[model samples]
Target: MVLLSCLQRCIQLLIWPVYILAYMGLWDSFYKRVFPYIMARFAPIYNQKVCKQKQELFSNLRKFAGPSGQLRLLEIGTGTGTNFQFYPPGCQLTCTDPNPNFRQFLLKSLSENPHVQLERSVVASGENLHEVPDGAVDVVVCTLVLCSVTNVSKVLKEVLRVLRLGGAFYFLEHVAADQSSWTYFWQKVCDPAWKCFGDGCSLSRETQKELEKTNFSELNLRRIHVAPRWSPTSPHIIGYAVK
Candidate 1:
C-alpha cells in the first residue's frame, strides 16, 4: 500500500506542472463563472455527512447568543454562503470573503435562506479582519477557511480579538495528515498546484495546531473524514472553543 501510494504521488507530482500550467490563463474566468455553479450544486451533497456536527455548533451558538435572541455571527471566508442553510434562528450574520466574486453567489443563498439575517457583507480578507470591531461578536464561525489564509496565527489572533468574553470560534477545517502517511507527503508535493486552483487553500495546513496556539479559554477539537474523495484535503477538524 505504501509503495503504491508513493508511486501514485510521484506520478502526480511529475504531471502537476502540466495540470497547473493549463489552468493559469483560464483560472480567473473559471473561478468567476464556473466555480459558483459547481459550489451551489456540490455544497448540499458535501454537507450531508457534516451537517450534524455543524448543527451542534449552531445549537451552542444559539445558547450563547441568549435572550435578545441575536447571535452576532461573523463568518470569515463565507464562500458562496454554503453554510446559510445551517445557521440557526436569530443569527445577525456578518459575512466576509476575500474574493469579491462570491458576493453575488452569497446574495443568492441569502435570498433562499431568509432565516439568516444579513447584518453586513464585507469584502475583507480573514488575515486582517479590518472591517470587524474588536470584542463585537458573539461567535466567530470559520468553516473550511483556516487553510488558505496568508497567516493562520494572525487570523486566529484576530478571531480571538474580535470575540467577546465567553464568545466562541467555530471551526471546521481540513488539516495536514499524520507525518508518516503518504497523504502527508502528497499534500506537501501537490500543495502549490492545489493552492493555485483552490483559491489559496493549503492542503498541508494543520489548522488545529494553529488554533491551539491562540489564548482561548477552551478548545474541543476532533478529527473526522468527509467525502467526494478529495484526497489530502478530506481529513478535517470540527469543534468550538470559547474565549
Candidate 2:
C-alpha cells in the first residue's frame, strides 16, 4: 500500500512540472483563478466544521471598537471573505490577499454580509503588508494563512506593526501533528507536493511555535482537533493575541 502511494506521488510530482511549463509561468494565474471556485464548493463544509470555533474566536469584537463606534479590522489572506459572517455589525474591514482573483468573490461575500463595510482590498502577501500603515488597525485576523506564508514569524511581525496599541491579532490555522504520530510522518512526506498544488500551503508547519516565539503581549492560543489524529489538518490552533 505504501509503495503504491509513493508511486502515485512520484507520478504526480513528475507530471506537475510539465503542467506548470505548459502554462508558461501562468500557473499562478490559473491556480488563483481556479482556487476560488474550488473554495466556493468547499467553504460550506469547512465553515460548518469550524463554525463554533470561529464564533468563539470572533466573539465580542465590538469591545475593540474605537471612539467612532466602529472596528478597524484588517484580514490577511482574506480569500473570499469567509470570515465576514462572523464579524460584528460595524466593522470597516480591510482585506488582503496575494491573489487578485479572490477580489471578485470577496466582493460578493461583502455584498451578502451587508453589515460589514469594505475598506479596501489590497493584493499583498502576509509577510509584507506595506500597503497598510503602521498601527493603523485595531484588529488583525488571519485564518488558514500562516501555513502558506514563506515566513510565519515575519508575517506575525507585520501583524503587530499594523495593529494599534492594545489591539488584537486573531488567528486560526492548521499545524503539524505530534512528531511521533503517523499523521506527522505523512505531513512531512506530503508537504512538498502539497505546496505545489495547495498554493504554497505547507502541510507540516509548526505555526503554534512561531506564535509563541512572537512578541505578542498576551497569547491566548489553544489547539483543537477538528479531525481525527490520522488527518493532516487534524490539530488546529484557534485564538487571539493582544498586541
Candidate 3:
C-alpha cells in the first residue's frame, strides 16, 4: 500500500504543471501532437481489447459493410484510425479530427484497411462537421469522443442531423464513474489536469447520459471497466442509438 500511496502523491504533485500548461494554452499542442506519439504505442492494444469486449455490438455494424448500397460511415474524432481493423470491406469511411497531427497515423491505418474507402479526411471537430452534409451518413461512429467535445448535447444534435432515417450511431466512451466511489472523486479532482494533457479528455463526463438525452428512436447502452493504466478510460459504455 505504501507504493500506491507514493504513486498517488506523485500524481497529485504532477497535476500542477499540467494545470499551468492548460491555462497557458500550451497543452493543446502537446495534446494534439505529442500525445498521439505516446498513444500510438499503447492505444492499439487497448483499442483491440475494447473491440473484443464489444464484439457482439460491433457485429451489428458489420451488416452495413457490403458492396451493394455501401454504408457511408462518419467517424468523428478518429484518433490515429484505431478503429480501422473493426471495419469490413465496402465501407465508405469519412474520418474527422480537429488535430491535423494525427493525419499521418490515420493515413497509415487507412492505407492498411484498404477495404474501407477513405471518403474524406477533414480537419474539423465534431461540433462543426460542415464538410459532411445533412442526412448523408448511415452510421456515425463515435468511440472515445464525446468526453472531450466542447458540447456533448450539441454534438449529438449535429449527429442526428447528419444521419439518414434509421441510421445508427455507435458509441464506446468512458463516462463518469459511480458517484459514491473514490474513483469518481479522484476523477472529478483530476479532471482539469487530465483534460490538459489528455487532449480534452474529461474524466467526469457522463457521455452515455448525454446520449440518452438526445433525440434517438432507441438507445441501447452497457457499462464496462478497462484498467489502471487507462483508469480514466474505465466505466465505459458500448452500444448504439438509432436516429
Candidate number of the best lDDT = 2
lDDT of 1 by residue, 1-243 (tens): 576567657766876765575567755555656666766677677788788877776666676683476789999989788788888865899998877777788989999999989999988988888778899899888987888788989888899889989898988988998888867877777776677666668888888878788899999889887753347877888889999
Q: Report the C-alpha lDDT of model 2 over 138-194, residue by residue, as the tens digit.
A: 999999999999899899999999999989999999999998888887787777667
Task: Give all candidates' CA lDDT scores.
Answer: 0.81, 0.87, 0.81
lDDT of 2 at 163: 93
TM-score of each: 0.85, 0.92, 0.88
Each candidate: RMSD: 3.5, 2.6, 3.9
Candidate 3 global CA lDDT score: 0.81
Could you tell me the lDDT of residue 167 within candidate 3?
88
Arranged by lDDT with the best first, the candidates are: 2, 3, 1
Give the least accurate 10-residue stretch of model 2, judged by summed lDDT: 3-12
